[model samples]
Target: DPPNAHIEVSDDGQGIADQRVDGRYGLAIMAERAERIRGRLEIRPRHPHGTTVAVVLGPAGRRDSV
Candidate 1:
């Protein structure tokens, strides 16, 4: 809606706290890519389980939704 788009993924594992979480380049790379396309990336821990990764890009691309 509103010329915006959202992409999301989630898991049911132990989440970010239990993992080493440091010296990891995956998330960094993802975030950089998002910024390059004028988007935002988010990471959040699930209440009872894993993690959620989301990307939102908006106001600058094709608005048609299929």
Candidate 2:
């Protein structure tokens, strides 16, 4: 089996929208950093409220492994 690593953060405040996120440079920077490390960055609204931010990577030291 391969090594898997992920970091997740959740908030209880109002969720963010795509339109609102467009003006936020921090999110873009985070997404770019994740891509450079072969990781996936996800930002989505949580159930009913709040938001979730996650960075998931597969296979340690394996950048090509998605």
What's each prediction's clash count?
A: 0, 0
RMSD of 2: 4.2
List, residue by residue over 1-66, the lDDT tens digit for candidate 1: 563788999999888764556788888898988887878799999879899999888888544442
lDDT of 2: 0.80
The per-model lDDT (C-alpha) reads 0.80, 0.80
Write model 2 residue lDDT over 1-66, tens digit each, in one string: 453887899999988865755466988888888888877799989888999999888775355543
TM per prediction: 0.75, 0.75
Q: What's the distance in Å from true for residue 13, model 1?
A: 0.6
Ten-residue segment with the worst summed lDDT in candidate 2? 57-66
Cα RMSD to the true fold for all candidates: 4.2, 4.2
